[model samples]
Target chain A: MLMIKTVLHFDSVSFRYPKQEKGPLIYDSMKFTVREGEFVSILGPSGAGKSTLFRLITGLEQPTGGKILLNGEYFSNRLGHVGYMPQQDLLMPWRTIWENAALPLQIKGSKQADMRISVEELLKEFGLGGHEDRYPAELSGGMRQRVSFLRTILTGSQVLLLDEPFSALDAITRLSMQEWLLKQWEKRKKTILFITHDVNEALFLSERIFVLTDPPVSRMEDIPVPLDRPRTLKALDIPEIMVLKDRLIDQLRTKATT
Target chain B: MKKWREHTYSFILLVVVLVLWEAIAFNIKMTFILPSPTDILMKLWELKKVLLLEHLPATLCIILIGLGISIILGVGLAISMNSSKIIEKAFYPLIIFSQMIPTIALAPIFILWFGYSIWSKVLVTVLITFFPITINTYDGLRAGSNDLKELLLTMGAKKKDVFLLVNVPSAMPHFFSGLKVAVTLSVIGAAIGEWLGAQAGLGYFSRRMMTQFDGAGVFAPIIVLSAMGIMLFLLVKWVENKTLMWRKSE
Candidate 1:
């Protein structure tokens, strides 16, 4: 089989926030590569700078050291190659679901006629076709997340960065969202970089997981998921997957104790 | 239905005030000082031909023209101020100073420059009305949460889009709040300006009656002026409700 090339490379990336003792260094000499079409989840505890990592990828924050390359080129805002789904949904309350989903396309100056068709397709695919006119407030948390997700996809970006997109939901809703998200990802096959503190979330969704430590820190481990493709809820009971879970749990527990 | 009930209370209060005024006026027997509401209404009816057709139109024109200019300038200046901290720093203090100076105090100066023409009244109204709009727009622009701003930036929202989509719309409620105050001020400003110097206006008519010791006539013009203000206020409120229908459901 032919090897897939790296789409994103974070080379010795280090970020130090200003105006703090020792500065807020979330990544120190951190290096990683996300292969084309890969779903990589950055998993860490709260304040571990997982969210900041998303900001870095989106160009909201620049790394103090090292470089970020997308598709072997220097990352630039002009690329418009990354779709970001923030934690809060970030839906404009003034706009209906259709309008909100259509916004990115509109901003990109896509034809208004095409926007309707494209948005409609995405909405229907995401199971939100009938609720087009409803405001963000009218939708449930899970539905909002789905709309936000579709919005990201509609940005026409090759890469999607999700920042705890499901953390706001209840457990039952979150599980359903996860299943839905995986299905969508399977269809789109876009490179995804997700940030979450939920170990099971990382385990359930990503093809690879990077466990990051606290401030002034580096990656604790970058482990390729050994689970098979087209995974289901039943796959969680696999002994090997359970062993992997236990190992990650132990890492988190030890880190907490220390 | 609930709002209609709320309106009824104010109506009842108005009726009580009118009844008390007529009773007290009749008991004391002084039509020259505090005319009965009935007497005032009769005078208003007799003068409606001239007052509503001529003086009322003049006052309405000045108020509308002044309000239109102020809203445009105020919202434009507010957007500019929000765009740059330097602009905000330079203009914000001056705007505060203008508010403190009081339009009434400066009405004479306006009369000196524009004479007894409609321009003078319009100028005064604009001065009185613009402040609240500027202050409210500024407040609205500043009200956006940091995360929301950052979210737009990350999503590739241009500076213009951020202002237009996020800032302007977010500031709308505050803008309307200021507009409400400005609408009332527009009438007050025009009336006060006309009171100081004018050939024709409700204020001019009221002053004419007051000097003649026609208390009923003066009260008639005063009531009409008040009704005009209320009418303008309700019109602005109607527009506000229509434009900001999204807010009402919330």
Candidate 2:
């Protein structure tokens, strides 16, 4: 079997806020790796420093100690190697869906004509056809999220980091979005590190899940879901899924209490 | 339909006010103190040649030039201030202090310096109009959500790209809002400057009329000035609406 390269690696990372010199560390000697073309989800409780990890990866914040390697290259406090979708949609209210999605390409100094063509094609594939002229306010929440997601993918990065992308969606919409995302991931074959607090979501989407304990994230449990490809809602009914879900939940509950 | 109703109501109120004015003027029998609407209209028609030919052009020229200068300078200053924390810290207090010195009080000084020329009036208009635009644009530029800025930075966007794409567009609504106030004030500023000292303008003409106790003449230019103010305000509003079509007007 061909070896899948690691797209993102955190080698014994440590971080703490500057203002809180005496406070408890947010991360202490954290370590993880995401393979190329794999869907990996980071599952943790609230206030578990998941966002801080994302900031560090995106180069928005610098790690106090340790190294972050992207595509086998170490980058400290630098951005633009990975695609990032923030927790909020963050679509400019003044811009249309097409313009908003085209922003990444525009920033890269792509020709307007080329940007429009690519963005339009992607919008159609995202099931947002014929909504090119509509502003952010006119779109539904789910549609907005899809537009945001489309924008992230258009950035042309090999790895994508989504920070709780569907957290604000209704349960039904969130489920549908997850399925849609999985379909997109399979087609694109890009390395994706998804962050979510929900155990079921993590199980349903990722091949391997990183269950992080609350802050100072000193240790993590990596659970592998040996499920078949092209998963559905019916995957939740499988006996193995149930067993893993209970085990993961018990682990999280115990960690939370302790 | 709603707009039509509003127009009809305004017309009715205007007619009621005019009728009351005519009744009061007739009862007092003092055209010098309070001219009847007919007297004012007659005077407007009589002086229409001089008013439209001589004074209106001068006033319009001064107001437009003043407004143009204010917009360019205000927007420039706002962008500069927004780009640097040091500039913002240094200039913000001075800008506020400038506003405290009433433009009306300084109008005479401008007139003295510029010697009753159109420049004095333009300066007054600039002084009156620029502050709001600068302040509003500055606030708008700074008001961009941090998440959006961070997202842009992560997308490999340079600082210039962020300013042009995010800050400039975001500042537009506030710019238009400031323009509305500035446009209305431009008329008053021009009038004040002309009133202080001017060879020819509606303001100068009105002052002459006031001194001569020609109530109808005074009232004619006053009506024209108010109309000019309203028309300029509406023009700014129309442009704002066209430019910011994404904004739903409440």
Candidate 3:
């Protein structure tokens, strides 16, 4: 029996925004793959096209050249294959917390009776069970971010594209959210390509980290993290991981200098 | 603390105005030309049933009908402009020109076309009310956040879904703000239309009372018109609050 791998394969993807004469292209021959249930973080500087990577992978922009495939199927042909969570909570202020959580299902034209139980389970899983009736404004930033995550998960897409999902939260909240997200990712086991600027966060959550420079953006280094599951702050204190971090940091610094 | 102070200060200012009006009236007996707070209150109490219960409903019907038409046309035009740059380019000039054409001047045209009927009043209300709604909705729709839109596009939301869900809801605050202006405009528009030509309304009643030189009578209906305007304004505000409570919580 051949074991099938649900993977996102990017080959030579290139793109630029409208009306730009010459600048670092957001993507230039970018290529990578996220296997089933793998968490891959793309770490780069502010203008490094990390955000654009999410855009390209999620079909927001058509790459000037390249092919993108998810589970051996072309991205162009698929419908509703990937779920995207933006930096902002993006919860509709008019909707109740429950309604906001249920928005993906609502948009997909799912039936109320069916979505209720699934949404209930998801809210409980994300520790937002009782917040069903409350509006998005009533929730704290951390809580709203958690709800946004749940909304992404509820979409039932195999591939999840998250753009700076925890960038808005405070340090303490972001720490906790990273742990929570890791645990959820473990259970749900979807292929995730998360974009973030934080080196520590990329190291903490990603199975593999792709460090990127500012556009003319190519992968600086694709470092595999050998840390154990449910990685703790203590694990990050390991000598080899520290050395790898220093190396990654130095590469980013050299890119910045050039 | 800052929010609380704002609320408290506004409340105090309202009480001060009412107190001053009542106090000066007591000091020097004033006529109905500038009715005192007390006199207005007394008149309101006596005629509440007749004004609020009867004539107020008539005025309200014109306002609601006019306001509804404005929203539909404004939102419809906004959607059209959003979809086609050419349509926006074509109508942008016309919308500005229409705004320049004074609503007061157009009231008589409405009367001439629709006659001295409720239709004329409604037409006038629509003319006054439509512009704000259109401008606000257009700006709101056009000024939608790129990040949110990109996110939706990636999520495989179709164009219609983006418009109905993201664009429309995002523009809602702007739309309601426009509605707030239109709410006041509708009342004024209806009255102004009636001012030009009408069978029965507060405007017609005010004219009749003015002809008789019954200052109190004229004052009475004017007060009622103001009260009606306030009611409609508050009603729109209440709806705004209910719909946009999330903004406050945010």
TM-score of each: 0.95, 0.96, 0.87
Docking class of 3: medium
lDDT winner, 1 or 3: 1
- Model 1, position B190, has a per-residue lDDT of 85
Question: Which parts of model 3 have CA positions greater than 4 angstroms off?
Answer: A1-6, A21-26, A77-79, A217-220, B1-58
Q: Highest lDDT among the candidates is held by which one?
A: 2
Residue range A63-171, candidate 2, lDDT tens digits: 8889999988897646777899998999999888899999999998999899899899989999999999889999988999999999999889999999999999999
DockQ scores for all predicted structures: 0.48, 0.62, 0.56
Better of 1 and 2 by DockQ: 2
lDDT of 1 by residue, A1-258 (tens): 998978888889888875554756767888888898999998877777788787788888778889999888886552256788989898888778998998888778789789888888878878898988788888898999999988888887888999999988999999999988888888888999999878898999999998887677765478888888888888987999999999998887777777
- List the per-model TM-score of the A chain: 0.94, 0.96, 0.92
Q: Residue-wise lDDT of candidate 1 within B21-126, one digit each (tens)?
A: 8899999888989889889889999999999999999999999899899989999999889989999999999999987886788789988998988999999999
Model 1 residue runs over 4 Å out of place are: A18-24, A76-79
Which scores better on lDDT, 2 or 3? 2
Question: Global lDDT of each model?
Answer: 0.86, 0.90, 0.81
| lDDT string, candidate 3, B1-250, tens digits | 8888879978999899989977877777654455577676676677668766667777778888999999999999998999999999999889989988877976777777877778989988888899999999999897777776666666667888878878888888999899999888787887777778776777777777677755556668788888778887898899988888777766
- Evaluate model 2: give its TM-score: 0.96
State the displacement of the C-alpha of residue A59, model 1, in Å, after optimal TM-score superposition.
0.8
